[model samples]
Target: MKLITLLPILLCLFTVAAKAQDNNGSNPQEKKVLKLINALPEIIASNKLRMKKDPQRLLKAYIEFTPTAKDKYYQVSVCDDFADRLFAYYRFKVNAATYAIFYDDFENGKLVPLKVWQKHAYGIYSKR
Candidate 1:
């Protein structure tokens, strides 16, 4: 009778374990950020974008600073080629898989929204 009672408990534990294993893909946001990082070279190659710092270095920093949850975000700034004046800033929302990019003239100290990129399903990012 004790073995019969224990059997149901064992089965319940096994079911919970299997469900946890099935939901193992928990880093979707990180993967989305990495996709953006990988696309940097292509974005620069098109001659449509410019950055003062090396793209690879910036990517490394971005990855390090990116947060895992929705409430936290990462921010970085870029200066001119001379590295003397801040020209742009980028804020990344990992949970939402979006970037809020801003540009500043440095003379007026005003930042204007340059673009917003949102990552969609299958790792495609679209400008908003």
Candidate 2:
């Protein structure tokens, strides 16, 4: 008798939980984009720490992002306005589905995994 009485309540709770997990049924791509956008501040903060020199010696460093063709990734570009010039710091390709990040290796002519990219970039940028 008690099991029967509690079953409807359990079903209602489960339905609510499922709905909450889906962001109220919004588009999946939109959710991914929003998640990345929301994380931008933390991302920029971390990259700032990787700088060998103070990128903000004259002005603040900032990061920008745009969806790549076909929307599979976001092209993340870093730059700073200093000394009356736009100084580009680095570029990254962020996966839309997995949120994985890759460094745009202009020197090597290929995208490199972030850990490898970081090792190389941080070597060039950070003092160790």
Give me the candidate number with maximum TM-score: 2
RMSD of each: 15.7, 16.5
For candidate 2, lDDT tens digit of each residue in 65-96? Answer: 44567657665555555575666556667786
Measured by TM-score, how close is model 1 to the native structure?
A: 0.27
Off by over 4 Å in 2: 1-65, 68-71, 121-128
| Candidate 1 residue lDDT tens string, 8-94 | 999998778432211112376545554554455433442233435344233221333444465454333222223432332333333
Off by over 4 Å in 1: 1-26, 40-43, 46-62, 68-71, 75-128
What lDDT score goes with residue 26 in model 1? 39
TM-score of the candidate numbered 2? 0.44
